[model samples]
Target: MEANLTPQQLWDCALRLLSRRDHSRRELAQKLRQRQFDPEWIEQALDRLEQQHWLADSRFAAVQVRQHVLKRHGPLRIRAELQRKGVGPAEIAQALAAEDPDWFELARLCYRARFGPDERLDMKERARRMRYLQARGFAPDHIRYALESADE
Candidate 1:
């Protein structure tokens, strides 16, 4: 509710949100504001959480990168998503670098899973497949390797 909230209640709400999943400080702040919590109270609650080490942008970014990679999303899409979540570029870069899954292999797997046997495709068919991979956020080199080098 957007009604009056004691500091404790605000902190409880933030803890509840964090219990479900990691959230950037900005995301937690935005959610509290949306609930009509007083801005000062929101800031206080966030600061307390940070002091308790219950909130961390770096941890949030790391989890996001791993999750997106597992979903077959490429680095570009993952980086953009992290940025949208208010993660700093340095944290995003560190998270991405840490995860560093074999992107080329991932692209190949995604291509195989989506298109099945890489039958000798005509130029038009190849182009269409290439478009699909690109939309999935794969780099051009990875896409080319997947389409050309994947077993027929």
Candidate 2:
């Protein structure tokens, strides 16, 4: 169990996890905790990783934002996801800004992909599409634009 493991082993495990992919300190800590690593040891390992520039919330946020954007997820979903991952507000804002996705266009693309660009929807169907885009985390304005101009 944890008694048999040393701090060095925890550190190595942290590095091994990081070598596979970057992780936010909180995420990394949670992972270590799941393995029943000592809380103190986890803190020290996280501090060392931060000091060595190996684990960074900001970097994790950036990668997350890029990946979500590619999946056509909007700002609301992306921000919520970063928050869930324990990314700071400043880092989330910075990463979103860095990506600078054209949310309107992205919404339009999603809408077009779901319903053909030239297709006309009945009132109920239009409402349904609106809800779909809203659930996809688009802003009200962006969803409006997407519906109105998806064909154009």
Candidate 3:
């Protein structure tokens, strides 16, 4: 891959990436780095983007949370994914609060979507459903709420 692009070219590359999707500043830096861009140039380019509000961690976090919620993922998984993308804790928390997803309701929806609504289950099936919700990143309490509410 050609990695000898000028600073102008590097800026353009960043723009092209942002045009496709919102990217956290760190994520954009990593992407540019993967293409073998100089670390210093990448940082400077990122700074320019951030100064201009073209790249924002908060915006990226918000977008990520919304997208994952639409995909029926739980908060724990969402938090981990955002951290991996280099979002700060404060931004992640603020984004989550801004979205304000009802965890229990979301858990129930995911549970129902996966296992169907309120079918009687043996111990084995019950354990399987719990595991499924757990894997989807719901808190233990949220999973319990989702499952228990089905009984009422």
* Candidate 2 weakest ten by summed lDDT: 112-121
| Model 3: per-residue Cα lDDT over 1-152, one tens digit each | 46567889889899999999999888899899897777899999999899999999999999999999998889999999999999999999999999999999999999888877686779998998999998888999999999998877
Candidate 2 residues lying further than 4 Å off, grouped into runs, are none
RMSD of candidates 1 onward, in order: 1.7, 1.2, 1.5
**Which residues of candidate 1, in runs, are more than 4 Å off?**
1-3
The estimated TM-scores of all candidates read 0.91, 0.95, 0.95
Q: Kindly list the per-residue Cα lDDT of model 1 for residues 1-152, writing each as its tens digit.
A: 45566777787889999999999999999998887788998988888888888999999999999999888987777888888889999999999999989989899988888888866778898899889888888889989888876754
What residue pairs clash in candidate 2, if any at all?
Answer: none
What would the TM-score be for candidate 2 when compared with the true structure?
0.95
Best by lDDT: 3
- Candidate 2 per-residue lDDT over residues 12-94, each given as its tens digit: 89999999998988899999999888999899889988999999999999999999999898999999988998999999999
